[model samples]
Target: MTDTLIKLAVQAQFRTRPTLRSVVAQMLTEHLQEKYPPLTLPVAQLRLALPREGGGRGLSPLVEVALDYLASGIFPDLTARDGLDAYLSDASGTRLSFEQNGTRHYDLAVVEALIRELPVIVQVGFQDALMAYWNMPSDAGGSRWQWFAGILQDQLRAAAIRQLAGDVPALQRINQLTDYPARETRSQRHGPESSLHAYSVQTRLVQGETQVTVQSSDLLLVDGKQVWLCNLSGRIEAYASLDAFGQALGSAHGRPVYRRQPHLATL
Candidate 1:
């Protein structure tokens, strides 16, 4: 049986299947649980200390002595208050709002400020993920997959930091990546101009239900007659002709022994 491969540019982030945000949250949660076991803290209390929540421990007489000092240090714009809860309430009330295309958007600078106060572990995780990601060359094969994976790793790192700062027993974030679609860049190749036009190519063989897919990122012009396909997370494959590339792809995917239609540019 032969396989099929399709390639196309998605308006959303690359790799639309398997949500990246879910993957990221999963990684971070796993990391945290590994480091800190036996989750027992109440969910509400955990929310108070998380980075996105501003690392506020909520109301407690024991926290009052340090409330003024901490609130002033964390929320400089906040005024002095008689109690910790009052101070947190005042800080929470402070918000930044803006309108875009008649749509209202709120910026939680105060919440982000708390993220900055996360412990060193979270900070280190973020830094490491970033370093690994940035180190990868954009032109390399599978870089796009790496890019998506890296972004998730970074997000997880950030979440982990929030979890640590909040003293949360566990991380709880949903993967809503599918909500965002892949976008086209100015230099993105498409249609006849694109060497590989399908966002994802799939072919099936006659004998079985197995399908073959080629995550062609871009086409590299080796010469006037030769071209190379940069796969998503694989090595570059050289094709003597576009027709040959299609045939090979079909064969790989278990396509029948026949002249395969080329999945390439019009040229």
Candidate 2:
């Protein structure tokens, strides 16, 4: 079947689906596994050696506040405790009692309202979030991060949609992508320091199913499109494609794919 190709924005972080509801569903599904009704604030659990005297304290400065936000049905996909603004209880207890601030006075009614709305809000939010991914480049042929693009497929797509179908009408959209995966540039660097690992994805869409696949190779991107494949692990086997990348990952014992950042041991 003929495939459609589209160029994506350079800075696009995600590909969005056609509808706003889909975006909301994706966001909620992404957060559902998070610790809800959090008993403690994020990063609240800190360990400190007891002073020679007698001092052991838990609960960070933001603990109660964070808890309040959780109670508010805020987004759970957040990475930090400081992000607990809406869900955690505000300090003024305006969320609890006499409303000095816009926060509802702390009352079971307020808490109950949040609890009642949590699932619905999250579902809609996540559906919208998934739609955002489509806004990114779905054209496998042009995708430099083709491997990751391939994983953004229908099984996962349907799974994401199914999550919302339980509560909201399923979002329906037509998505199509086409791409090519050839080393844009061949490796020229010879020394040990000249090495990198990269991946590619190639896809074709058929009527009933989306055929997505991924590949990997060692390389570094240059000048936007040039690729320099490398031999990092001291072997020619380093030049692996998608199928080989999977095989190497499954068979290897120590590490499959290791991308380390500054101060990160193994990210």
Candidate 3:
């Protein structure tokens, strides 16, 4: 009865909004039904095979399976044949699977759980980031799914860093001064004489009726052989050394006077 209801719901949806993909999927299912008996798996059997972390409430496994079936038919190219699963497995630690009936499934629960753990501001920021990525021209990248996975991973990493550093006084001061909802700081060493240190910030501003959001990064490259300051105004300044960058930051006009003020009276 559950299987019959799910098929009826999907069929009704297709009738309301018919598309080439849906028509093809219907035809395929019909053709397969002629050769083999329909599988009547129970709802519990169709639930996500992986165990969820916190067991948070979300869409029923049956609904998730239905959506997965629809997505598989609509986006056939993103399946194993197109290498999306392989790319995502390596890049984002996410995997996609296929059921016996050929429906493709991914761990939507995991993604939803991660997003739910983030702060509201971070959630909004991630939405904006996704929209911007979606608006990019087709020629800008090869696979939209791959780019999207990358963006998700980046946001998750930033959010995790912010959450872990929430109690650190120095990081709190930096966050307060930058006015950025989320920030990521990292230092890495590569080979003998090469190193990199960077602070990336994300913020939103309102101008008239328009709201603008931007991301900027201050980077020290190759063990301070060079410094790059990317500002919210979309300006990039390159300096030969840390000292040069410090001088520019200190003397630049229109700089916030309060930034130079010492937080402690002794300083």
**For this target, which candidate reaches the highest TM-score against the unseen true structure?**
3
lDDT of each: 0.36, 0.31, 0.37
lDDT (10s digit) by residue, model 2, range 1-267: 111221234233344334433333333223322423232322222111111212322222232222344456452221223322222333322121233455342233333344345455655555544544444454445433453545433333344343434433112210111122222322232223323323332222223444433333332222222222223221222223444434443453565343221110110
Off by over 4 Å in 3: 1-141, 144-193, 196-222, 229-236, 252-257, 260-267
RMSD for each of the candidates: 22.5, 20.3, 22.5
Over the stretch 1-267, how does candidate 1's per-residue lDDT look in tens digits?
Answer: 011221223223333343323333333344433433432222122222112234433432212222332345443333323333222222233222334567342223433343334333444555555555545544434565565555433443354444334533222111111112122321142223422222234333343454443434443322345545544433345568756666676664454454333344321
The runs of at least 3 residues in candidate 2 whose Cα sits more than 4 Å from the true structure, single-residue gaps closed, are 1-9, 12-106, 112-124, 132-246, 254-267
What TM-score, computed on C-alpha atoms, does each candidate reach?
0.22, 0.23, 0.23
Model 1 stretches with alpha carbons more than 4 Å out: 1-199, 208-226, 252-267
Instruction: Write the candidate numbers in order of decreasing TM-score.
Output: 3, 2, 1
Q: Whole-model lDDT, candidate 2? A: 0.31
